[model samples]
Target: MSAPFDLARQRFLTRCTVVSLPKPSPGAPPPSVVYYMHRDCRVQDNWAMVRASQLAREHSVPLKVFYPLFPSFGNMSSRQYSFQLAGLAAVEAELRELRVAFHLDHSSPPAAAVPAFAAAHGAIAVVTDHLPLRLLRSTNAAVAAELDALPGPVPLIQVDAANVVPVWEASGKREVGARTLRPKIGKLYGRFLTQFPPVPKMPAGSPLPPPTDWSAARAALKVAQVPDAPGLTAGTAAGMAHFRGFCETRLKKYAAVRNDPNEDAQSGMSPWVRFGQVGFQRLALDARKLGKHGEGVAAFIEEGVVRRELSDNFCFYNEEYDNLKGAAGWARESLELHNKDKREYTYTLAQFEKGETHDDLWNAAQLQLVGEGRMHGFMRMYWAKKILEWTESAEQALEWGLLLNDKYAMDGSCPNGYVGVAWSVMGTHDMGWKERDVFGKIRFMNYAGCKRKFQIEPFVSRYPPAAENCRKAGGEVALAPGVKAGKKKQKKA
Candidate 1:
């Protein structure tokens, strides 16, 4: 492959997986190179797309980007579809400027869609981005199978464009935690973290895939009930601008106030990053350049690269990623030990969805997730742990947690969401803690701990429980605001 385009190919051939290599066909007009935009959706800073462009240039073939759009993706609704399509609209525009054709295939299953599209387009090679999630992985496998079955088979290649360090290269097995995976990525980051080369403009002539029919696309969506987030704009440009704003203003305080829900200290880039509108490597590279915010930069790297990639590593290596089966042996045993324990509070999925839980803080967090499409990072830990506390079994808890997260959060259905919920309920990457009644050995989080960490009232006040929820919680809603647990003012006798 001409000594592999750059350092990425040189250091770790694992960065790209060669599924099938078809022999060159005798033809006059060279075949096209297909870049299937899946996990990483951006125009630039995407290794998968870059590699496809390189292959097209080398083979003297036209370059094309195809996104197989399903009417519905998992539990995703209009909220997610709107954001995704908006970003894709930008992708079409950018690819047009670069003179590359962008095709939107509204096929039911991408596995079928991708190979059929390649065959129809006379593709010589198909390059795509990697996603560890089961659906995408299965789709990749099925596509590879279909490609191999074709009369004139073409090579199928995958690039790990999502993570700063490729998941497979980072670790071969499911890592126990960030501690185990951090060093492995640290050793390899120098080689993989280098700046991405531009995806050179393709020679003109191939018609730009008609400007995406976004309205028709939206109208065709099967899941359109969920409302889109209020102020969240979707596009690489907006995502980059958000990151720049964070670096300029919020980054300095990120280290200190990130845990405080009341502070707007988060990077707020998850929706963009998760949707592949922005790349993690880009975030890390940009953050590393801000030496002035050293502490924040370090913390950001810990979260963005080490922690985030750790989630990817977990999902990629562990087949049972979203359930109790994926938990550590000790964690599984501990959860099993506590499975029969009585719960002081148990709420149905409907109640949980409505934020009708007794704890106002938990209710507020749930409200934030439903209303804003995300919850505070600190609160998410408390939120999921409480599910384990209130649900019937560890299994049910994991189920409910995943359901809610996948249904609500903009970044839901990704490895990070799976790992986050697993960490909270099943202790996937966390160690067993001191045994407790409902939680057993898994890490425990409570309202009091949150109160100690941040001003609970300000955050809770922002998303107050509905009056009906307050009534259901036995009128404790008034006590939640600014009042510490166990110190609520006693009613006058």
Candidate 2:
């Protein structure tokens, strides 16, 4: 077995499991290496792209970057599509400068998209980043099979570029909680967290096919266009700008005011990170250099590094991660015992989507997701918990909550999103709390409990409740009687 450091580096080569598919045809002439850029979208500090460039350089062959555009995947909306399409423009330009080809495949089903193109181009190998979601995994398996049968055997490689510490390296099983996973990651992160050597610029080769028609790609997806999300922009440069500003201005106050919804102390990098516009390794290296502390820096690393990877671990290992079955056996049993418990109110999925709940605070959280494509990180817990309270059953609430969240949240549809909803409703990684009417042993979050932490009413006014639950002249929210909420949470899954 290789030493941990060497193995860690090899693990980082693609993003998830470093797969060398098609079994490498020996004695076969080297063909172009193609990189199917998926979840991670940035050009700099990207391991998958970096490794692909290296392989292409070693083989003395051309490198092709492909972005397969499925008309739509799952419940992702137009707003999400708009951000993804816009972010690729920068990725295209950067790859061109590096002498790599960038192609956006818009042909109906993405499963056939890349393999068909690679076969036509007589590609020898394909490299792409990782994602732990089941749907994406199925799509990848289908694509790999196609590549293997292509006129020639074509190899496909996958790298874990999204996580600072690859999920498998972090833990082999779904961790019980952040505490259990934190030390494991802390022990090894130092070795894997070193600087990412840049992808050395390649000589200007033949130009790539005409730049992908982003406008047409946008039209093809046909998703709803939510207002441009505040502070969250689409692209590597924008992501860096937002992250740099967060480290400079808000890093110090993050630990104190992060849970307060009205504060801007959050990193606001979800949309960027979700789309791979920014690399987590880049953020960590810079954070260390800044030397910020006081729970702010420590907590940020815990969430961004350990906790974030735990979410992927959950999805990668637990096939039932998105539903109640994914919860702990204790949690599932407790919820089942109370599935028919009477509730103060019950709302349908449509009602939940329209933010028509009786709770003003809940409605405000929903509106924030609807109008801006994001909800304050702390409020996400409150939002999901409320769904469980107001809906008919835990199963219904879980499904509706996932549906609403995946449809609106900019960071929705990844392992983080699935694990978050599971954690919120199913208590996947949490200890059993005091039993309650509906929640049973599940960790319950309510409006009063949130008030004990920070004033949540001002957040309601800021987003404006639905017509049924009108907001009065509620002014600024205060953390205490005289103090106002001063910081926002650093980041979310």
Return the top candidate by TM-score. Answer: 1
lDDT of 2 at 3: 18
Candidate 2 C-alpha lDDT tens digits along 1-493:
1112233433322223332333446664346778888899988888888778877777767788888987776678877877888899989998888878888878657678878777765576787788888777888888888876765566677778888878778888878988888888888887788777677677666557887887777777755555555555689998899888888899888988888887888888888888999988888888887865647887787778887888888888888888887889999999999898998778777777877755667777898898888988999999998888888899988888888888898888888888888888888888789988888889887666877776665666576554245223222222334555466522211
Whole-model Cα lDDT of every candidate shown, in order? 0.82, 0.77
Clashing pairs counted in every model? 0, 13
Off by over 4 Å in 1: 1-30, 466-468, 478-493
On lDDT, the leading prediction is: 1
Query: Global lDDT for candidate 2?
Result: 0.77
RMSD of each: 3.7, 5.9
Worst 10 residues of 2 by lDDT: 470-479
What tens-digit string does per-residue lDDT give for candidate 1 at 1-493? 1123453431211222343335556762346899988878899988888888988888777888999987877677788888899999999989888999998877467888998888878787788888788888788888888777766666687788888777777888888888998899999888788888888788877766567777877777788488788789999999999999999999999999898888999999999999999998899988987778899999988999999998888888887898888888899998999999999878899999999976777888899999999998988999999999999999999999988888889888888889999999988877778999978999888766776788766777787564347558664553555457665632210
